[model samples]
Target: MSALGLKIIDESVQQANIWINEVDYRVGLVNKQRAYRLLRAVLHALRDQLTPDTAAHLSAQLPIFVRGIFYEGYNPSSMPAAIRDKDDFIARVVAIFGPEPPEDITGAIGGVFDVLDARLSPGEMAQLRGQMARDIRALFAD
Candidate 1:
Protein backbone atom coordinates (compact mmCIF):
# COMPACT_ATOMS: atom_id res chain seq x y z
CA MET A 1 0.00 0.00 0.00
CA SER A 2 2.81 2.38 0.86
CA ALA A 3 4.49 1.53 -2.43
CA LEU A 4 1.30 2.08 -4.38
CA GLY A 5 0.64 5.35 -2.60
CA LEU A 6 4.13 6.49 -3.47
CA LYS A 7 3.62 5.69 -7.11
CA ILE A 8 0.38 7.64 -7.31
CA ILE A 9 1.99 10.57 -5.62
CA ASP A 10 4.96 10.48 -7.97
CA GLU A 11 2.81 10.38 -11.07
CA SER A 12 0.66 13.23 -9.81
CA VAL A 13 3.73 15.31 -9.06
CA GLN A 14 5.24 14.68 -12.47
CA GLN A 15 2.01 15.64 -14.15
CA ALA A 16 1.67 18.75 -12.00
CA ASN A 17 5.25 19.80 -12.69
CA ILE A 18 4.72 19.40 -16.40
CA TRP A 19 1.51 21.36 -16.23
CA ILE A 20 3.20 24.18 -14.31
CA ASN A 21 6.03 24.34 -16.80
CA GLU A 22 3.58 24.51 -19.66
CA VAL A 23 1.59 27.25 -17.97
CA ASP A 24 4.76 29.25 -17.33
CA TYR A 25 5.86 28.91 -20.92
CA ARG A 26 2.46 29.97 -22.23
CA VAL A 27 2.21 32.88 -19.84
CA GLY A 28 5.47 34.25 -21.15
CA LEU A 29 4.19 34.42 -24.72
CA VAL A 30 0.46 35.10 -24.46
CA ASN A 31 -1.94 37.87 -23.54
CA LYS A 32 -3.88 37.58 -20.28
CA GLN A 33 -6.84 35.99 -22.05
CA ARG A 34 -4.63 33.43 -23.75
CA ALA A 35 -2.71 32.68 -20.58
CA TYR A 36 -5.92 32.10 -18.68
CA ARG A 37 -7.16 29.83 -21.43
CA LEU A 38 -3.99 27.81 -21.14
CA LEU A 39 -4.47 27.53 -17.39
CA ARG A 40 -8.02 26.31 -18.01
CA ALA A 41 -6.73 23.75 -20.44
CA VAL A 42 -4.27 22.51 -17.84
CA LEU A 43 -7.00 22.28 -15.25
CA HIS A 44 -9.16 20.34 -17.65
CA ALA A 45 -6.37 17.93 -18.34
CA LEU A 46 -5.77 17.39 -14.63
CA ARG A 47 -9.50 17.01 -14.03
CA ASP A 48 -9.67 14.25 -16.60
CA GLN A 49 -7.23 12.18 -14.58
CA LEU A 50 -9.30 12.36 -11.41
CA THR A 51 -12.04 9.93 -10.33
CA PRO A 52 -15.57 11.13 -10.96
CA ASP A 53 -16.26 11.98 -7.33
CA THR A 54 -12.95 13.75 -6.91
CA ALA A 55 -13.38 15.47 -10.26
CA ALA A 56 -16.77 16.85 -9.35
CA HIS A 57 -15.50 18.24 -6.07
CA LEU A 58 -12.53 19.84 -7.78
CA SER A 59 -14.57 21.14 -10.68
CA ALA A 60 -16.55 23.26 -8.26
CA GLN A 61 -13.38 24.51 -6.66
CA LEU A 62 -11.65 25.35 -9.93
CA PRO A 63 -13.43 28.65 -10.43
CA ILE A 64 -11.22 29.99 -7.67
CA PHE A 65 -8.19 29.52 -9.86
CA VAL A 66 -9.96 30.94 -12.88
CA ARG A 67 -10.98 34.05 -11.00
CA GLY A 68 -7.46 34.55 -9.77
CA ILE A 69 -6.14 34.44 -13.30
CA PHE A 70 -8.84 36.49 -14.99
CA TYR A 71 -9.81 39.16 -12.50
CA GLU A 72 -7.59 42.21 -12.13
CA GLY A 73 -6.25 42.90 -8.64
CA TYR A 74 -8.26 40.06 -7.17
CA ASN A 75 -7.44 39.42 -3.55
CA PRO A 76 -7.47 35.77 -2.53
CA SER A 77 -9.29 36.74 0.64
CA SER A 78 -12.13 38.24 -1.40
CA MET A 79 -12.69 34.85 -2.95
CA PRO A 80 -14.34 31.99 -1.11
CA ALA A 81 -12.25 30.42 1.64
CA ALA A 82 -9.50 28.30 0.15
CA ILE A 83 -8.66 26.64 3.46
CA ARG A 84 -12.08 25.05 3.74
CA ASP A 85 -12.20 24.11 0.09
CA LYS A 86 -8.68 22.66 0.11
CA ASP A 87 -9.47 20.24 2.92
CA ASP A 88 -12.23 18.73 0.82
CA PHE A 89 -9.93 18.57 -2.16
CA ILE A 90 -7.23 16.78 -0.21
CA ALA A 91 -9.74 14.39 1.31
CA ARG A 92 -11.17 13.56 -2.07
CA VAL A 93 -7.76 12.91 -3.52
CA VAL A 94 -6.84 10.58 -0.67
CA ALA A 95 -10.14 8.70 -0.87
CA ILE A 96 -10.10 8.30 -4.63
CA PHE A 97 -6.45 7.57 -5.12
CA GLY A 98 -5.74 5.37 -2.14
CA PRO A 99 -6.93 2.02 -3.38
CA GLU A 100 -4.83 1.86 -6.51
CA PRO A 101 -2.16 4.52 -6.29
CA PRO A 102 1.00 3.45 -8.07
CA GLU A 103 3.97 1.90 -6.26
CA ASP A 104 7.25 3.75 -5.63
CA ILE A 105 5.55 7.12 -5.73
CA THR A 106 4.56 7.88 -2.16
CA GLY A 107 7.13 10.65 -1.85
CA ALA A 108 5.80 12.32 -4.95
CA ILE A 109 2.27 12.23 -3.61
CA GLY A 110 3.50 13.68 -0.32
CA GLY A 111 5.45 16.35 -2.19
CA VAL A 112 2.47 17.46 -4.26
CA PHE A 113 0.28 17.61 -1.20
CA ASP A 114 2.97 19.57 0.58
CA VAL A 115 3.16 22.10 -2.22
CA LEU A 116 -0.62 22.54 -2.43
CA ASP A 117 -1.01 22.85 1.31
CA ALA A 118 1.59 25.60 1.43
CA ARG A 119 -1.10 28.12 0.46
CA LEU A 120 -3.13 27.58 3.60
CA SER A 121 -2.87 29.14 7.06
CA PRO A 122 -0.39 27.39 9.31
CA GLY A 123 -2.96 25.84 11.63
CA GLU A 124 -5.36 24.77 8.91
CA MET A 125 -2.48 23.57 6.81
CA ALA A 126 -1.15 21.41 9.62
CA GLN A 127 -4.59 19.90 10.08
CA LEU A 128 -4.76 19.00 6.41
CA ARG A 129 -1.30 17.46 6.52
CA GLY A 130 -2.25 15.40 9.51
CA GLN A 131 -5.40 14.25 7.74
CA MET A 132 -3.39 13.20 4.71
CA ALA A 133 -0.92 11.30 6.86
CA ARG A 134 -3.76 9.55 8.65
CA ASP A 135 -5.40 8.68 5.39
CA ILE A 136 -2.21 7.17 4.07
CA ARG A 137 -1.82 5.11 7.21
CA ALA A 138 -5.39 3.90 6.90
CA LEU A 139 -4.74 2.84 3.35
CA PHE A 140 -1.79 0.76 4.44
CA ALA A 141 -3.56 -0.81 7.41
CA ASP A 142 -5.51 -3.30 5.41
Candidate 2:
Protein backbone atom coordinates (compact mmCIF):
# COMPACT_ATOMS: atom_id res chain seq x y z
CA MET A 1 0.00 0.00 0.00
CA SER A 2 3.04 2.24 0.28
CA ALA A 3 3.79 3.95 -2.97
CA LEU A 4 7.42 4.41 -1.91
CA GLY A 5 7.96 0.61 -1.88
CA LEU A 6 10.60 0.82 0.88
CA LYS A 7 8.76 -0.30 4.01
CA ILE A 8 10.63 1.69 6.63
CA ILE A 9 10.50 4.95 4.75
CA ASP A 10 6.86 4.34 3.88
CA GLU A 11 5.94 3.56 7.46
CA SER A 12 7.74 6.65 8.80
CA VAL A 13 6.01 8.85 6.27
CA GLN A 14 2.68 7.33 7.23
CA GLN A 15 3.37 8.07 10.89
CA ALA A 16 4.16 11.69 10.07
CA ASN A 17 0.98 11.93 8.04
CA ILE A 18 -0.99 10.60 10.96
CA TRP A 19 0.18 13.47 13.16
CA ILE A 20 -0.50 16.06 10.49
CA ASN A 21 -3.94 14.66 9.81
CA GLU A 22 -4.65 14.57 13.52
CA VAL A 23 -3.67 18.23 13.84
CA ASP A 24 -5.84 19.09 10.85
CA TYR A 25 -8.77 17.19 12.29
CA ARG A 26 -8.37 18.59 15.79
CA VAL A 27 -8.20 22.18 14.54
CA GLY A 28 -11.19 21.70 12.22
CA LEU A 29 -9.00 22.81 9.36
CA VAL A 30 -10.25 22.00 5.88
CA ASN A 31 -6.81 22.82 4.47
CA LYS A 32 -3.86 20.57 5.18
CA GLN A 33 -1.47 23.48 4.55
CA ARG A 34 -3.11 25.49 7.31
CA ALA A 35 -2.77 22.59 9.69
CA TYR A 36 0.90 22.30 8.75
CA ARG A 37 1.39 25.98 9.57
CA LEU A 38 -0.15 25.52 12.98
CA LEU A 39 1.93 22.44 13.74
CA ARG A 40 5.20 23.95 12.54
CA ALA A 41 4.59 27.19 14.38
CA VAL A 42 3.74 25.56 17.67
CA LEU A 43 6.55 23.05 17.40
CA HIS A 44 9.14 25.72 16.72
CA ALA A 45 7.86 28.05 19.43
CA LEU A 46 7.83 25.26 22.00
CA ARG A 47 11.26 23.99 20.95
CA ASP A 48 12.86 27.40 21.42
CA GLN A 49 11.43 27.68 24.91
CA LEU A 50 12.89 24.43 26.24
CA THR A 51 16.38 23.96 27.60
CA PRO A 52 18.66 22.54 24.92
CA ASP A 53 18.93 19.19 26.69
CA THR A 54 15.20 18.83 27.17
CA ALA A 55 14.55 19.92 23.61
CA ALA A 56 16.91 17.30 22.27
CA HIS A 57 15.30 14.58 24.36
CA LEU A 58 11.85 15.60 23.18
CA SER A 59 12.82 15.82 19.51
CA ALA A 60 14.43 12.39 19.69
CA GLN A 61 10.98 10.97 20.34
CA LEU A 62 9.32 12.70 17.39
CA PRO A 63 8.54 10.86 14.18
CA ILE A 64 11.27 11.08 11.47
CA PHE A 65 9.79 13.89 9.38
CA VAL A 66 8.25 15.61 12.34
CA ARG A 67 11.64 15.57 14.04
CA GLY A 68 13.11 17.36 11.05
CA ILE A 69 10.38 19.97 11.24
CA PHE A 70 10.99 20.35 14.96
CA TYR A 71 14.68 21.05 14.30
CA GLU A 72 14.35 23.12 11.14
CA GLY A 73 15.89 26.37 12.41
CA TYR A 74 17.35 25.16 15.67
CA ASN A 75 20.52 26.70 17.10
CA PRO A 76 21.34 25.16 20.44
CA SER A 77 23.87 27.85 21.33
CA SER A 78 21.22 30.57 21.16
CA MET A 79 18.40 28.41 22.31
CA PRO A 80 16.11 28.30 25.38
CA ALA A 81 15.46 31.87 24.33
CA ALA A 82 13.97 33.99 27.11
CA ILE A 83 10.39 33.15 26.20
CA ARG A 84 9.40 33.27 29.86
CA ASP A 85 5.62 33.74 29.57
CA LYS A 86 2.50 32.90 27.59
CA ASP A 87 2.07 36.18 25.72
CA ASP A 88 5.62 35.99 24.40
CA PHE A 89 4.98 32.43 23.26
CA ILE A 90 1.68 33.31 21.60
CA ALA A 91 3.29 36.30 19.95
CA ARG A 92 5.95 34.04 18.46
CA VAL A 93 3.28 31.72 17.04
CA VAL A 94 1.25 34.63 15.70
CA ALA A 95 4.34 35.97 13.94
CA ILE A 96 4.71 32.56 12.32
CA PHE A 97 1.08 32.56 11.16
CA GLY A 98 1.66 36.05 9.68
CA PRO A 99 -1.19 37.93 8.00
CA GLU A 100 -3.94 35.32 8.00
CA PRO A 101 -4.18 34.66 11.71
CA PRO A 102 -6.48 32.08 13.22
CA GLU A 103 -9.69 33.28 14.81
CA ASP A 104 -8.99 31.20 17.91
CA ILE A 105 -5.27 31.14 18.59
CA THR A 106 -5.75 29.46 21.94
CA GLY A 107 -7.87 26.75 20.36
CA ALA A 108 -5.32 26.24 17.59
CA ILE A 109 -2.45 25.96 20.06
CA GLY A 110 -4.46 23.77 22.44
CA GLY A 111 -5.38 21.56 19.51
CA VAL A 112 -1.70 20.83 18.76
CA PHE A 113 -1.06 20.06 22.42
CA ASP A 114 -4.09 17.76 22.44
CA VAL A 115 -2.79 15.71 19.51
CA LEU A 116 0.76 15.60 20.90
CA ASP A 117 -0.61 14.21 24.18
CA ALA A 118 -1.26 10.97 22.34
CA ARG A 119 2.02 10.92 20.43
CA LEU A 120 4.35 11.73 23.34
CA SER A 121 5.04 9.57 26.38
CA PRO A 122 3.05 10.87 29.32
CA GLY A 123 6.11 11.14 31.54
CA GLU A 124 8.08 13.08 28.94
CA MET A 125 5.13 15.34 28.26
CA ALA A 126 4.61 15.93 31.94
CA GLN A 127 8.22 16.88 32.50
CA LEU A 128 8.25 19.24 29.53
CA ARG A 129 4.97 20.81 30.66
CA GLY A 130 6.31 21.28 34.15
CA GLN A 131 9.37 23.15 32.91
CA MET A 132 7.32 25.78 31.11
CA ALA A 133 5.77 28.87 32.70
CA ARG A 134 2.34 28.37 34.23
CA ASP A 135 0.56 30.58 31.71
CA ILE A 136 2.21 28.75 28.83
CA ARG A 137 1.42 25.41 30.44
CA ALA A 138 -2.23 26.36 30.60
CA LEU A 139 -2.27 26.41 26.82
CA PHE A 140 -1.63 22.67 26.93
CA ALA A 141 -3.89 21.86 29.84
CA ASP A 142 -6.60 19.33 29.01
Candidate 3:
Protein backbone atom coordinates (compact mmCIF):
# COMPACT_ATOMS: atom_id res chain seq x y z
CA MET A 1 0.00 0.00 0.00
CA SER A 2 1.20 3.49 -0.73
CA ALA A 3 1.90 5.74 2.23
CA LEU A 4 -0.38 8.80 2.39
CA GLY A 5 2.51 11.14 3.05
CA LEU A 6 4.44 9.80 0.08
CA LYS A 7 1.42 10.19 -2.14
CA ILE A 8 0.99 13.81 -1.17
CA ILE A 9 4.67 14.59 -1.48
CA ASP A 10 4.93 12.82 -4.78
CA GLU A 11 1.95 14.64 -6.21
CA SER A 12 3.26 18.00 -5.05
CA VAL A 13 6.71 17.38 -6.46
CA GLN A 14 5.23 16.26 -9.77
CA GLN A 15 3.11 19.37 -9.97
CA ALA A 16 6.10 21.56 -9.24
CA ASN A 17 8.06 19.84 -11.98
CA ILE A 18 5.20 20.35 -14.39
CA TRP A 19 5.08 24.04 -13.59
CA ILE A 20 8.81 24.43 -14.07
CA ASN A 21 8.61 22.59 -17.35
CA GLU A 22 5.77 24.78 -18.47
CA VAL A 23 7.81 27.85 -17.65
CA ASP A 24 10.77 26.45 -19.51
CA TYR A 25 8.60 25.80 -22.53
CA ARG A 26 7.03 29.23 -22.44
CA VAL A 27 10.33 31.06 -22.08
CA GLY A 28 12.09 28.98 -24.77
CA LEU A 29 14.80 28.01 -22.31
CA VAL A 30 16.23 24.58 -21.61
CA ASN A 31 17.63 25.89 -18.33
CA LYS A 32 15.40 25.19 -15.34
CA GLN A 33 17.19 27.79 -13.20
CA ARG A 34 16.49 30.58 -15.70
CA ALA A 35 12.86 29.50 -15.90
CA TYR A 36 12.55 29.56 -12.12
CA ARG A 37 14.11 33.00 -11.83
CA LEU A 38 11.72 34.37 -14.46
CA LEU A 39 8.77 32.67 -12.81
CA ARG A 40 9.52 33.99 -9.32
CA ALA A 41 10.29 37.49 -10.52
CA VAL A 42 7.05 37.81 -12.47
CA LEU A 43 4.98 36.22 -9.70
CA HIS A 44 6.24 38.66 -7.10
CA ALA A 45 5.43 41.63 -9.33
CA LEU A 46 1.94 40.36 -10.08
CA ARG A 47 1.25 39.48 -6.46
CA ASP A 48 2.20 42.95 -5.25
CA GLN A 49 -0.37 44.51 -7.58
CA LEU A 50 -3.32 42.30 -6.68
CA THR A 51 -5.93 42.68 -4.00
CA PRO A 52 -5.83 39.95 -1.37
CA ASP A 53 -9.01 38.37 -2.67
CA THR A 54 -7.87 38.44 -6.29
CA ALA A 55 -4.45 37.17 -5.31
CA ALA A 56 -6.08 34.23 -3.55
CA HIS A 57 -8.18 33.54 -6.62
CA LEU A 58 -5.12 33.53 -8.87
CA SER A 59 -3.33 31.23 -6.45
CA ALA A 60 -6.19 28.75 -6.72
CA GLN A 61 -5.41 28.31 -10.42
CA LEU A 62 -1.73 27.58 -9.80
CA PRO A 63 -0.25 24.12 -9.26
CA ILE A 64 -0.23 23.16 -5.58
CA PHE A 65 3.53 23.57 -5.23
CA VAL A 66 3.56 26.76 -7.29
CA ARG A 67 0.87 28.31 -5.15
CA GLY A 68 3.38 28.55 -2.33
CA ILE A 69 5.80 30.34 -4.61
CA PHE A 70 3.06 32.74 -5.65
CA TYR A 71 2.42 33.74 -2.06
CA GLU A 72 5.99 33.71 -0.85
CA GLY A 73 6.73 36.81 1.23
CA TYR A 74 3.28 38.22 0.46
CA ASN A 75 2.06 41.02 2.66
CA PRO A 76 -1.51 41.77 1.71
CA SER A 77 -1.70 44.71 4.05
CA SER A 78 0.76 46.66 1.87
CA MET A 79 -0.27 45.44 -1.56
CA PRO A 80 -2.44 46.58 -4.46
CA ALA A 81 -0.25 49.61 -4.87
CA ALA A 82 -1.18 52.42 -7.25
CA ILE A 83 0.41 51.19 -10.44
CA ARG A 84 -1.52 52.90 -13.21
CA ASP A 85 1.56 53.40 -15.34
CA LYS A 86 3.30 50.77 -17.40
CA ASP A 87 6.76 52.01 -16.39
CA ASP A 88 5.76 51.71 -12.76
CA PHE A 89 4.60 48.13 -13.26
CA ILE A 90 7.69 47.31 -15.29
CA ALA A 91 9.93 48.89 -12.69
CA ARG A 92 8.38 46.78 -9.94
CA VAL A 93 8.98 43.63 -11.95
CA VAL A 94 12.53 44.69 -12.82
CA ALA A 95 13.44 45.37 -9.22
CA ILE A 96 12.55 41.80 -8.31
CA PHE A 97 15.33 40.58 -10.61
CA GLY A 98 17.98 42.28 -8.38
CA PRO A 99 20.61 44.93 -9.21
CA GLU A 100 21.29 43.79 -12.76
CA PRO A 101 17.81 43.32 -14.16
CA PRO A 102 17.34 41.62 -17.50
CA GLU A 103 17.41 43.82 -20.56
CA ASP A 104 14.39 42.18 -22.17
CA ILE A 105 12.08 42.86 -19.25
CA THR A 106 8.97 43.13 -21.40
CA GLY A 107 9.64 39.74 -22.92
CA ALA A 108 10.05 38.22 -19.47
CA ILE A 109 6.74 39.64 -18.30
CA GLY A 110 5.09 38.57 -21.54
CA GLY A 111 6.39 35.05 -21.11
CA VAL A 112 4.88 34.75 -17.65
CA PHE A 113 1.69 36.36 -18.93
CA ASP A 114 1.52 33.76 -21.66
CA VAL A 115 1.85 30.94 -19.14
CA LEU A 116 -0.88 32.41 -16.99
CA ASP A 117 -3.07 33.01 -20.00
CA ALA A 118 -2.71 29.41 -21.06
CA ARG A 119 -3.40 28.05 -17.56
CA LEU A 120 -6.28 30.42 -16.81
CA SER A 121 -9.57 31.07 -18.52
CA PRO A 122 -10.00 33.89 -21.04
CA GLY A 123 -12.29 35.86 -18.75
CA GLU A 124 -10.20 35.23 -15.66
CA MET A 125 -7.04 36.25 -17.47
CA ALA A 126 -8.76 39.37 -18.74
CA GLN A 127 -9.83 40.27 -15.22
CA LEU A 128 -6.27 40.22 -14.02
CA ARG A 129 -4.98 41.96 -17.13
CA GLY A 130 -7.60 44.65 -16.78
CA GLN A 131 -6.20 45.45 -13.38
CA MET A 132 -3.01 46.62 -15.02
CA ALA A 133 -2.30 49.78 -17.02
CA ARG A 134 -2.87 49.89 -20.78
CA ASP A 135 0.77 49.26 -21.70
CA ILE A 136 0.95 46.46 -19.22
CA ARG A 137 -2.16 44.94 -20.74
CA ALA A 138 -0.41 44.96 -24.11
CA LEU A 139 2.09 42.47 -22.68
CA PHE A 140 -0.66 39.91 -22.92
CA ALA A 141 -1.56 41.03 -26.43
CA ASP A 142 1.75 39.72 -27.71
For each candidate, C-alpha RMSD in Å? Answer: 16.4, 1.3, 2.2
Clash pairs, candidate 1, are 3-103, 4-102, 6-105, 6-106, 7-102, 7-105, 9-109
The runs of at least 3 residues in candidate 3 whose Cα sits more than 4 Å from the true structure, single-residue gaps closed, are 1-5, 99-101
TM-score of 2: 0.94
Residues 1-142, model 3: lDDT tens digits:
4456677778887888877788777767677877777788888888888899989988888877788888888899998977777788788777776765556778767887888888887877877987877787888854
Off by over 4 Å in 2: none
Residue 43 alpha-carbon offset, candidate 2, angstroms:
0.3
Q: How many clashes does the backbone of model 3 have? A: 0
So what's the TM-score on candidate 1? Answer: 0.28
TM-score against truth, every candidate: 0.28, 0.94, 0.86
lDDT pick, better of 2 and 3: 2
Which candidate number would show the highest TM-score if scored against the true structure? 2
Put down candidate 1 lDDT per residue, 1-142, tens digits, no spaces. Answer: 6456786566555554454444444335223333333444333323433344444444343234342332323233333322233334344444444443323233333443343343334554444334333444322212
- Give the range of the ten consecutive residues with the poorest summed lDDT in model 3: 1-10
**CA error at residue 47 for candidate 1, angstroms:** 1.0
Backbone clash numbers for all candidates listed: 7, 0, 0
